[model samples]
Target chain A: MSVPTSTPELLRASVEQFYARHMQLLDDGDAEAWAETFTEDGLFALPGRPEPTRGRAALAEGARRAHTERLASHETHRHWHGMLDIRPQDDGSVHVRCYALVVATPRGGEPRLHRSCVCRDVLVPAGSQWQVRSRRVTRDGF
Target chain B: MSVPTSTPELLRASVEQFYARHMQLLDDGDAEAWAETFTEDGLFALPGRPEPTRGRAALAEGARRAHTERLASHETHRHWHGMLDIRPQDDGSVHVRCYALVVATPRGGEPRLHRSCVCRDVLVPAGSQWQVRSRRVTRDGF
Candidate 1:
């Protein structure tokens, strides 16, 4: 596969592709694979939560629980991310901020916007790809 | 401003910036400004529509009519584009295909997924920026 030559180009392209897969894994309820996109000691935090979910194991468990809830509700969720602002840090890590909207469609109903949130992540190069070192999500209006 | 040196990188960056402004103008209900992002003889087509809207004047009028309807409904629409696939053509134009979702929030109600669609565009260089030469949208499940 061809790769972007410059640092900014490379980082932007990597981040876009990373989210395409990451969001898909989440929507597909592949909790373990989704968590694997993060570092072994990745941190997932929310704005109002005092404690964050640390480590890939914890992240996977969290996602699994959410997936179970979604399954029980008979709703399929799709995460759409856009308006990405990617900045490459001096330490080779990239800081990305974007708007994410979760659309949930019930088994036989119209789709609704479940959540509108701002997602920020610190991504570090993991071999040829990138792994999320830390992620913080802030929901809109709260 | 620092620009990417390579052609691919430059095209990618230009496309991203172009959509950033283009979508914002549409959402803000700036019909004329939004239409100006297209070329003078731009074409807008839809899947089932027999005739496409041609020329900047017609595009602006169509956008204005939509804006009027949106105002009457007391709903605000936000266009979120993601998963962009950008390709540079041999003739200096760029082809961009992306998934675009419209989220509409009523005056006093929760937000809903207004529409899910695939947007494809042909963009050409307009001095230092890019303008849409032609656009086609295909609605999901239709």
Candidate 2:
């Protein structure tokens, strides 16, 4: 296993790139593709909600379902992320806290802020890339 | 006014220390004290919410009311943060992102996972310290 050191600069860049890719994949409507951003034992859940879907396969399925059930079109939503806290873990993984503003732009309706989620992500090194091991999404209000 | 162009390490450390202190103040039941983390012109708001209070005075008032009206105590709220995205802005300030989780413990009840809010903070240099000029809170859930 590659020992992860505190390269704050690199980690900073990694997060920016990760958010960028997330938006791109989401816009592409490729749930499966987006799911690949996680590790095999990855989890995705609404933070503080009690449970999360475990493993990459389940996460992929969850993403697919969420996309189909909630979003009408990829163009309907856009997001901006701001970091609040970050720390590297002992196992060469990184823990992140971020706030996101998701805006929904329906066909003719004025852009509405859908939700703000405090996301907690655990990222691990996968091959030459950093893949998310888990994500807990928390939403405060509509 | 002090020049904000410090070393990268200093900038990063300042950010980390600022958050550590911020969390400490909140945990200490000093909401007004927490609000003091910002500068005179600081603007505070919770993202996705329409109403935002500007300036340190307003921010302090808002914090006081929220702490009182919510009738809640963060006495047991624990904050964990990670995933930092930091960029030095053109205006001699910094824009950053991080993910956070806040767990609250209530009296005679299971430890409740409180709202996880993203702290979007913009900092400007004040002497050797960085003070927040603006802050936006993006909460994940109740």
Candidate 3:
């Protein structure tokens, strides 16, 4: 297998683009690809929730669960992302953060902001692809 | 005058350090330094607030106003920033985004998380230091 590339600018751009695509895949209802974005032992945590979703299998299950229930049926969902920041770490890992908002539109109704959070992520090089090592979603609280 | 350095890593590091120092100055009550971090035409804006604080002088005045009333005299304020991401634009300006939390602790009371926001900044190269060209604060919404 070829060694993973670690250029800072490339890594930052790639990770960000990967995230952009990840959200798109979710909206497209591609559960497998969405889960593949994470490492085998990746972890995901949500604010105000005690238990975390861990590992690629669990991550995929979570994605499929949401995708099937939300986008595949009557309700339409769109993920909006902005304020993306990525840092290439000295050890070759990349730290990433961004703002995300989920808009849900009823079958024949207006759209509303269903949920929003700041995502803190750690990405590691996986061959030519970057995979999430861990992700934490900090929910917006007033 | 030196051409504004455009290397991605260097510019990002400089901007993050500048932001860190900017926060330190506010906590330290060094109003002059805090204000000088902005360009002559710097602007600061907040959500739900229509008007923006424009120009270095106005920026300084706003900083001093907050510092004197909250930090410099009575309560102690602490600003913490993380998830900093800087993008070096082709025009020699850099775009920055990060998460910030402000904690205020009374003389002998508990530290409270007073306010939190995601800061979006546009920084321009100014000699050896990066100056804030524009900053917008979006308060966290539940």
- Judged by lDDT against the true structure, how good is candidate 1? 0.82
Top lDDT hit:
1
For every prediction, compared with the true complex, DockQ reads 0.21, 0.09, 0.10
Q: In model 2, what is the error at residue A48, expressed in angstroms?
A: 9.4
DockQ of 2: 0.09
Worst 10 residues of 3 chain B by lDDT: B1-10
RMSD of 3: 9.1
lDDT of 2 by residue, B48-140 (tens): 667777777787777667556444542344455566677888788898777776645443343344666677778877676577887777877
Residue-level lDDT of model 1, residues A12-106, one tens digit each, is 67778989999999989899999999999999998677899999999999899999999999999999888776777778788877677888899
lDDT of 3 at B76: 65
Residues A1-142 of candidate 2: C-alpha lDDT, one tens digit per residue: 2323445545555655777897667655587877788887888787455688888677777767766754655446666665445677777888877666566777767775455556788888776567888888866431
Candidate 2 overall lDDT versus native: 0.66
Candidates by DockQ, descending order:
1, 3, 2
Better of 1 and 2 by TM-score: 1
User: Which one wins by DockQ: 2 or 3?
Assistant: 3
Error of 2 at B85 (Å): 15
What's each prediction's TM-score? Answer: 0.63, 0.58, 0.60
